[model samples]
Target: MSNNGDVFVIGGVEHMGHVGMMHGVDPNPHMSLYAAKASGMMGLTAEMLGKMHGITREAQDAFGVRSHRLAHQATVEGNFKDEIIPMQGYDENGFLKMYDFDETIRPETTLESLAALKPAFNPKG
Candidate 1:
């Protein structure tokens, strides 16, 4: 629920974040140009680039787990107080809502759980 009396709930969508803006024009050929193949090529390119630097799924997942853990720890320890600004407002139903921290972090993620995910970019893997 938003402060503007609009009830907003996020459903699940993955590729929308990548192939979303189909009508927009940009200097990057990746945007609005070859919209269908853009995502695959971009991911493959990124995976190749990472491979050049010796980054594998294990390394990537380890970094992600470490990242979430560090981020949660930092937030809990008030390390981001200087950068974070708390916002207080009313919900769509007029209930008071206070937001002071990141809500998207999965702090309890484990390396084993992360390993369950298939490598999307690395086709050979």
Candidate 2:
């Protein structure tokens, strides 16, 4: 006999809810030090790590473009139809709408557009 089990994992982030504290909180001296030295923001930390790993900006931009392209292609081909369920959500204009597709997928995203954008965490980089 064999033991079997099924596991389902789901994770998401609501950036709007943390807009005010995007840099993170410094609740104590230790946290303050950590935040000051190693930026409490995940994006900033990732930037630092990428720099340390010698990952070039062009590489990151290319990766982002490729990701958007793949997602857009999948959406157009209805590849995610079975996995995605329609949900009630508010639009930017505050109107109630049924979101049946992945809203984050940007079909128009391109390498030039990504390259023109400044780094979100490190503007200098």
Instruction: Specify the highest-TM-score model's number.
Output: 2
lDDT of 2: 0.76
Model 2, poorest ten-residue lDDT window? 1-10
Q: Per-model C-alpha lDDT, please?
A: 0.69, 0.76
Report the lDDT tens digits of candidate 2 across residue range 18-96: 4774445554657645445456566766687677678788888887888899989989999999978999999999999
Q: What is the TM-score of each candidate against the true structure?
A: 0.54, 0.70
- Candidate 1 lDDT tens digits, 1-125: 01244555544434546654333434475554655433444556567556666767787788789989998999999997886678987778999999787766789999999988777755575
Candidate 1: RMSD to truth:
12.6
Off by over 4 Å in 2: 1-12, 21-39
Listed per model in order, the count of residue pairs whose N, CA or C atoms clash below 3 Å is 0, 0
Best by lDDT: 2
TM-score of candidate 1 versus the correct structure, residues matched by position: 0.54
